[model samples]
Target: MSAGEPGTGVRARPRLTVVSGPSGVGKSTVVAELRRMDPTVFFSVSMTTRNQRPGEIDGAHYHFVDRARFDELAGRGEFLEWAEYAGNCYGTPRQPVLDALASGKPAILEIELQGARQVRVAMPEAQLVMLVPPSWETLVGRLTGRGTEDPEVVRHRLAVAEKELDAQGEFDALVVNTDVKQAAAELLTLMTGTAVRKPWSSS
Candidate 1:
């Protein structure tokens, strides 16, 4: 297939799906729930230059690499999508996603909005789902409740979340994340069309 939207001759549902939202939008929570609820799908693990957080396992949460290694991989065209966030670079390895899809399994990529845009240009046939918070107030609470970052960092994230929310229309679908399980179910259904949805609907 070409690196664009499929022609009229194509009928199969896209095997690749990109999930993106602003920081502190419960993306990690939803993804973890999705894994527990559906083992058949593939969730692409991203590589990042940021130091691993407490309780995070390398290769499970993210493949932690230094700046030089990350730059070398990016230069080699190994990343299908990549971007810098909070001064750290994150990228999705190209081959694993392709291999998963080639094996007839749906692949879910959790990335930033910038990387999602790159995926749209590179794989237009793939579905782009924008996950959002129930309301602006809830989003602020979530971002601040983490208490991991400084006040300045929290403000920056809230600003970025506002911009990401404005671009919701660019997505193929919108998923309001009121609860983790429901959001994951919605994402799973969007990818494979056969998930047992919980009690939640898109707004």
Candidate 2:
């Protein structure tokens, strides 16, 4: 079929979507679930200076780098947005996201609130969506998981989370995460305008 023909279904021009939330709000889980449901979605992987953990693959989980290398890249302005977290630096490489969008694949950036602000400045057209937990009690429970965290540490985390949650109004969209699969499907639908098959019928 010729381009833009009446019978040919034209694909929507994919856009860049920035997904952010509090530290323990299950943003990673939802993004992973979205990936499982649709491999075509372009989830932007970040580069970090933190040491890779046991199960992390270098290029997959994150592009692990030394502090000096990270600094060099930042100085050259290769990152769309970058920030320091827990004494380590993490940044989204700008080109890959542009490449994915130019080729018509929705690109998702699973980042922190700080980085999301930076992205807003760098790419004003990108969509910003915040993932919020079902409730404060649930977030507290998730933050205190295993009960191994120091009371002081947990308190600090909750304090930060409160501030992050307050910034929901700044976002273009909000996804409440009661179930990982449901939230993921909703996010995918928002990004693509196409509903996906639910993993299970009853839920």
Candidate 3:
């Protein structure tokens, strides 16, 4: 399909999908599965100062950069949205996402709640989606199950999750991440503005 031209079954304007949620709600899992199911969906790689975890590639997972470089980019107005979390700075570059959307490819941004809110203000047309767990207990289980954080860290994340959940109304839609397959499918549907089982009424 040509850029900005609707096809028989495809959307015209490229979709900008902002997926945000608490740290442990499986946002990454849903995004990974979406990319696997539809490779054409462009997933924007973020720039971060945090050290790479196991199995995370430099450019593929994130654009690993030093604090100085990150500051330089930020000064140049390179990031669409950025924030500091847990003593590390993370941000999304502006150019790549704009280019992808210009080329008629759906761009997916898996970011934090604050970043998502920033994008909503900057790009009103972008679709905002929040991934939620089935329940509080489930969310806590997923967070601790990762085995990547200590008790203090887990508690902090849960506290943050509670606040994030309270901001669900700010998003255009909310997809419960109880079932990975189902959530991914719903996300794809939201990105395309196509019909799937209605998760929540969009505001």
Clashes of each: 0, 0, 0
Q: After superposition, how far is residue 7 of candidate 3 from its true place, in Å?
A: 15
lDDT of 1 by residue, 75-146 (tens): 998998999977999999999988998888889998888999998987766788999999999999988988
Candidate-wise lDDT, in order: 0.85, 0.88, 0.88
**Runs off by more than 4 Å, candidate 1:** 1-14, 52-54, 147-149, 194-203
For candidate 3, write residues 1-203 as lDDT tens digits. Answer: 33433334545466689999998888999999999889999999999999999999999989999999999999998998999988999999999999998887999999999999989987887888999999999988888888977899899889999999999988888999989999999998778754233355372
The C-alpha local distance difference test score for the whole of candidate 1 amounts to 0.85
Residue 66 displacement (Å), model 2: 1.5
- Given candidate 3, what's the lDDT at residue 113? 90
Over 4 Å off in model 2, which ranges? Answer: 1-11, 194-203
- Which of the predicted structures, 1 or 3, would earn the higher TM-score when compared with the native? 3
Model 3 compared with the native: what TM-score? Answer: 0.85
What tens digits encode model 2's per-residue C-alpha lDDT throughout 1-203? 54432344554457788999998999999999999999999989899999999999988999999999999999999999999988999999999999999888899999989999999999987878999999999999999985888999999999999999999987888999999999999898778763222344242
- Order of all candidates by lDDT, from best down to worst? 2, 3, 1
Winner by lDDT: 2
